[model samples]
Target: MRITEPYTIFLRRLPSGKSVYYYQFRDEDGKRSPAYSTGTNKIAQARRVCQRLYNEGKFKKSNEILFKTFASGFFDDESDFCKWKEVNGSSLAKSTIASYKRLLENQILPFFGSMKLKKINTDTVKRWIVWCSEKCSAKTSNNAQSVFNIIMKSAKEKKLISEVPSSELAFRKIKKKERELLTVEELNRIYHSPLWGWECARRAFLTCAITGMRIGEITGLQTFEVGDDRLNVEHTLHPKFGLGPTKTRVCRFVPIPKSLGLKRQCGKTWAFEKPTEEKPCRADYIYGKLMLICDSLGIDHKARGITVHSLRNMFISYMRGSSFGETIDLKIKAVVGHADESMTDWYTYWKPEMFPEIYEIQEKLFKEITEV
Candidate 1:
């Protein structure tokens, strides 16, 4: 049923098969949008709830202010945190939302769920931090604290809490391991190694080394997007987020070495199929594969901090070490899709005509690859 008198209303069925009546209204900016839901399927009940919500100025609250209950509403399908389909909505990457939920369920919610939002303060969170430090890495603990901050901020935004208490209790800095890059010779060994006898892995590994695209980009590359001298580095494929925005939320066109050739479709398929078939290179699989080959070749991965990403670092290292040095430096950044101010904003203007000198260095770099 449609109600288009003072506002617009539509009966929408969620993925869960439950139908809810959603209303569209003009926000402060004078733009029409879906602001909230009626949370019921029966027409008469839905209309009554909608009327009540509107009478209360479209903001509803329960008598009790439990952390668990507020969190549920904050992440409701209509809100931005976990929403995927709303237009002009500020949503986090799906994996991030999932992690927040998981963190709450596993750690934060268990401790704070029954308590009121105002009752959770820095001291309460510090206890959780201490507990997390005993079991998790600095990175993971930091993630939980971040989610906690978001919950507090959201509570304040929704008028659930009068103020956020000690909200600056961000976790301590995390000391990340240095990523050791692979030398040209070491990279060449893996390039030549028959360990990646499978065509998909072989093509994918070579692509990563030469172009320096992220694993997400490499796995998301399509046949139509590959060109003679460039690649449309547009999308990323995350296991949890599925296909969404690139890491930078901007599209980049990366230059490739002419010598780094693909069989028309380097990274087209979404996932792995039979081992013999052409499929998108899985990041975790490639990480393990690189480690396996390194072990077999007597290369010290842990000591060197070498991983699949090291190939991208290797490409950057090659560019920095090349004779073209002072000149074509921005070109190098543009070639690798780096967000460098020295180059064009879109990084799309680097035709071979603009920097003919970089092609020679790229050729020399690619010459080191002993393709499988």
Candidate 2:
């Protein structure tokens, strides 16, 4: 039966050892529901429950009704997304999930949370792209966009939305910058700097310099991944994407100089290792240490445009100046784990200790520029 107003009355004892006391009312949909007041059996408590039910009714409705009331229902099914997150959370690393959570909470949810899934148009998605571009780098904007697209794709699969907005239409073109390289002087400064106390930082830097492996690949290397004085570039521990395949999704081995028997923790073969929980020997750690060294050397680390990746470039350059010139392609490809050999052919390779020849060429080039 429909009750027009909120009120309460105590009923005689039922089969159970309790008396029924509650206010009954029809919601906005004209469906009957009850508001219970157990202990007091009081009208005031019943009315409070009724008020709460009414407030809840304001937002609880079909997708259309929700859109009309809240301007969006995209977040209405957020619990489902939360469930998905929890499931994926277990399979992935904490940092990976954290990054995804940041994108969902800070970027995607803010824009489309309340909007009905079907109502989200390309225009709105484009606006999000513009907003991301204004606030973040192109790479970051693209990553955020990717997360949004993934959600929309899931919604489409679930029939929550008939169509997913085309994300390519919202894409912003980003210019690629040249890779930075450090000069020999800067390298020497870093090697000698006292700021780098953690031996791993120095070793990892030199490893990257000689091996040309990406930071993630270098850091993620387990003892088993190395063999015969060679580093096997196979896996990477991405900051946001978690442990997975390298960018090429291919593994290659990099030969190391036999002169250096870099060993940390006896019987451990991992090229880089740190004391458990004491500190991480990751590329970021090494990069930070390098920055500290740069600061101590009075160098503008930021303006100088040097990065850990520069070590790889130095390796490529050094290889080109060596005697084994034609072998550059195979060596660089093996060291850097390049999937495409054409890209690897860009650099010339020379012998390992041809510093004199390289300096002679450099000197001649400098003289030409100076004389002119």
* Maximum-lDDT candidate: 1
TM-score of each candidate structure, all chains considered together:
0.73, 0.59
Q: What is the C-alpha RMSD of each candidate to the true structure, in Å?
A: 7.9, 12.3
lDDT (tens digit, per residue) of candidate 2 on 1-372: 964553334444556776656555554565654443333355566456456545544323333322223322223323345455557753334455466667777776666766775677788788878877778888777777776776677656755567778545755677876655676666766676667776666767766755667888877777666554555667787655556767665655666554334443312544566755433366678888988887888877677577787777776776676565755456555557665755544564533343343334333322322232
Model 1 residue pairs with clashes: none
TM-score between model 1 and native: 0.73
lDDT of 1 by residue, 271-324 (tens): 222265555657787777788889989999999988788788877777777776
Task: Report the lDDT of model 1 for residue 239.
Answer: 70
